[model samples]
Target: MTKEQIIFLHIPKTAGTTLREIVYAQYAVDRITPIYRDERFMDMETFSQLPPEKKDAADIFIGHFAYGFHQHLSGNRPYKYATMLRHPIARGLSLYNHLKNLQFAGSEISFSELLKNKGSQFRNNQSRYIAGWGTQKMLETAIQNIEKDFLFVGITERFNESLLLASHDLGWQLKPYKRRNVTSTMWATNYADQLRNDKESMQELQKLNTIDMQLYEYANKRFSQQIASHFPNAVEKLLHFENRLHQAA
Candidate 1:
């Protein structure tokens, strides 16, 4: 093994936990899972928060925050950076249902109310971290800040394909597919009744989820170009993985 490490920048509700599990299994390396108790750093503005010795120790760092790995990247430390994203509408709905579960258990706000005021109460992962509210600023930020050398940027809609691309990059033959965030899926299905019953609520949800709708549209359009840039043989690799799975079945 060449001993190069991969940094997985996990975006919330994007099947990231499942991806991390697969990566951990395939690579046989400890994965960085974000829990406040774990010693992994979350502070993005401060470099010193992540101790140099700790940075040198890990073969893979996977978490729900952004740090450019300056020490590793600038110094030829043999690190590859990758991130994953979900369609905005799907991600927003996932967040809503998650919070709505709390409402059911006796939070003051109703699911309908939350949908109406989504811009304030709910933070899209981008809004929560990188940019502010549902503004064009997010698009601008993404365009400006995106790495030209992102090893792989996984799209949640085509997750299996994304994994094959990442596996190929890591020189692994394993395939990752179908596993999803169980909690998120359950919450959505559980709350489907609320959505079905309230027409006004659904309309509010559409307004609140405008950012996600836009995100899905934008990502779907740009995905092909993104794949071509890094994974020249990505289509063939995905087809190969599909064939293997079918043969196994």
Candidate 2:
């Protein structure tokens, strides 16, 4: 068994729910250490105080926390970190729609207004989560951290490819599983479609997430390089993986 436990830093709306299910298949229920709710963050104080036995037994710790969670772990077990990134604008829109669905205090406001609102917490969220800061310049820090500390930084747009690469690299047996915590409603769909044509909204969205956009593009570049280095037969292997899923169906 792989001794390196995974500390998954799950950014919001980055296909993280689907990735969690895939990781779940590789470990027994007892091996997972759930840290926080969807909107809440991982509590480092509580995590560091986990009982020795429970801490020692954990093989994976998944949560919607910022990076540096590995430092909070209690045991001596070696660990690795992983995270996912998405197209910053798409992720930002998805997050907005989700909050709107929940009737967030300002749900009635326009998307542009939400971006302009200084209180909005979702802007440049992918970079913030990875770098553990909300500054515009932390984009380079996020990329440095990923390349230095993370086992892999997966991209949501290329989720299947990411999964297959991890499976091949780590000997993980990824059985077919359902996507969880999906966010598709008619209003959400309609708004997303209309938002594409609204140049002003789109421009504001891009401007607010400049750091996140750059971070995402860098991840895409690295993902392609990773595929070339680690799985040159990637296309054929991906097709075979899909064939198995169809056969199972």
Candidate 3:
């Protein structure tokens, strides 16, 4: 049987960098196409124009794009999609900190201010990315896509279990690796302290991402069902993976 091509829809601030490393390690360098944040190949116009041979040679496509890319690509091969979702509030905070770290041109704006900005992309970003639209239909379409099309949907809070389930489905022998692009624990602790001290701001941020919060809850429930239905020994295997990961650390 021909192996299905893997399409990883890497949502931001969801431990995607670490997962990308694990997935990439399983494939030969020449057999994978990493779209990542590369501007040249990010848009559909450029991605669709890749030489047919390059598309044919690649077995895995990892990227930050939304769901529709699979339909646009030129190929008859079957594709299996997977993605991880983060709690909307947590994701928003992480994104805020990441942008702050980069000293973005408008780095001085408060997280709440940024959320209120009309042009801000970070608000309800997960829902927007998954649905590819800004209307109520986007949330409906995103839930349907996840339920009907994705082979697996995972939650960042349950990272080990998610990886174990993905490995089981893909028939890969995955091992834990050191995390990449992580926010430091010290900074995270400080941020958490600030949030605790400012409940109003935190609440506002949560209110702003209502769509993402709903989507995340839906994804989390489906993730649990997927683990239950598909990976019977998921808990056991996840425990083993976590133990090994700790020892390596």
Per-residue lDDT tens digits of candidate 3, residues 4-24? Answer: 777878888888988888877
Give the Å shift of residue 167 in candidate 3: 1.3
Whole-model lDDT, model 3: 0.74
What stretches of model 1 exceed 4 Å from their correct place?
1-5, 30-50, 67-80, 102-108, 112-121, 127-136, 147-149, 168-172, 176-180, 184-189, 196-199, 209-215, 226-240, 243-249
- Between candidates 2 and 3, the one scoring higher on lDDT is 2
TM for every model, in the order presented, reads 0.69, 0.87, 0.86
| Arranged by TM-score, best first | 2, 3, 1
RMSD of each: 4.8, 2.8, 2.9
Per-residue lDDT of model 2, residues 37-68, tens digit only: 53354465677787767687888888778887
Candidate 3 lDDT at 224 equals 87
Which tens-of-lDDT digit does each residue in 1-249 have in candidate 1? 226666667766678878767766765553342322245644443423555656655666676555344443334357766667776655656666666675444566766566465545444454333332244566555534444434656688887766665665555556534575655556535554555466776666567556545655665566667667767887787788788767866
What lDDT does the true structure give each of the candidates? 0.58, 0.76, 0.74
lDDT of 2 at 30: 84
* lDDT over C-alpha atoms for residue 160 of model 3: 81
